[model samples]
Target: MKVPLEIRPGSDAGLGYVKYGNGPVHVLVMHDWLGDHASYDAVVPWLDGHALTYVFVDLRGYGQSIALTGEFTVEEIAADCLTLADQLGWGRFHVIGHSMTGMITQHIAADAPSRVTSAIAVCPVSAAGNRLSPEALTFFASTVDDDNALRRLFKFVSGGLSDEWADSKVQHSRATVAPACRRPYLDMLVTANFVDDVQGLATPFLVMVGDNDPGLDAKAMQRTFLAWHPNAELHVIPDCGHYPMQACPRYFATVVERFLKRHTT
Candidate 1:
């Protein structure tokens, strides 16, 4: 059955959302900056089987959500997130943020510790030593530039994935993206605090990343997080990249299910 989802105005942050699920635990699933609800299509089925409710949010300027002009800080997004949850009657819930949205999750965990039960930051963006981290920047610049290069890069990075698969995925991403929605998400990163933000956060956490992911120094970030907050655990999915939920749904679901079960209230 399709769950009823509605758009709720954020007053300041443009478009906000509210959706309901059936399980005792409610999860707010935040997508990568470029993604929409469709991004979860691969992982949702597995998540649905776990018998918990899920709320997938389209961040400001992405998908059906509206972008707040000028003042687009992560705090604004985070505030809208909590407000939307309140509007949905979710007194306490869990959050799972993927890719860039991981930054938003950290802001929430840091600011509203009492409302969130647990958080999973999946292949999240981290302190890159420098924003111009040459290798990582090259990966992103290619995606935003050369089409053929994007395909080759995808194949090279995702590893174990065939040429046909890589080509199709790249095509799908390029074809589906909203040309107008493409822009900066600096407010999000800024509001969340980069790299060392929310050290030793009290919120129980899980950090999952693909073995071949190049978004950040995955191993180093994981170690830094654990050193600061002893409550967090890390899971590395083999043969995957930044988009583990889509590239390795089965593995992603299993990891999430186990974590949710152990932490579910």
Candidate 2:
């Protein structure tokens, strides 16, 4: 029988998180631009509670932190996560970041190398940042108000998975994310670049990308993350898209656990 997770709400200041497990190895999991900590709900049941503890956090203006506001920069997000870890009394931890927050993982690991054990980036935007054209930037910015646009974007990234899936994700984003937080976050995603800061760092990174995810595919990982971090490794999930934890929970959990196990010691 599968073990039930020991879940708890964050009581301390900084980013709000839902804590799971009671294992010795600590991990901080952050969400993408689309959803909050709930984005990892599908993968929770498959995670190894006996070996690892996870704290799924809500960035400013997202989920439990919806009332918390900030400058909405990746640096600010990284700092909030570190602060939360300090409050939780964790001196060292691993970080798992998805999409936008994936970039934050790099920032955290580079800024505080002694504290971060390793980083797992899922369909991550590189520390170099994703520079979009003016037209593309305008379309992404419009996602805050245009549900259809956001839904279409989700569908495209997930390799046209299904309309139902796309719709669900769009609805989740609409409900959990603050509208005012969207544009500023988008600007941060497009403009933030700190590749120079993370390059040559000794931190180990497991950069995962879905083969079907056109935007952040295996080729993109090789050119950016793998090229920048000397200790980085790449994994391509077959038949998956942007959201592996959501699209292939069991397989995603297996891969993530394998990586964590190697570094936990």
The numbered model that scores best in lDDT is 2
**168-225 per-residue lDDT for model 1 (tens digits):** 7766656544444443463244234444667777888888878787644466555555
Candidate 2 lDDT, 1-265, residue by residue in tens: 4544544443346777788787899999999997999999999988988778899999898888887877999888888899989988999999999999889999999889999999999999989888898988888888889999998899888965889999999999999999889999988988988989998878889999998997888888888899989999999999999999999999999999999899986
lDDT for each candidate structure:
0.67, 0.89
* Model 2 stretches with alpha carbons more than 4 Å out: 1-12
Residue pairs clashing in model 2 are: none
RMSD of 1: 3.7
**Poorest 10 consecutive residues of model 1 by lDDT?**
186-195
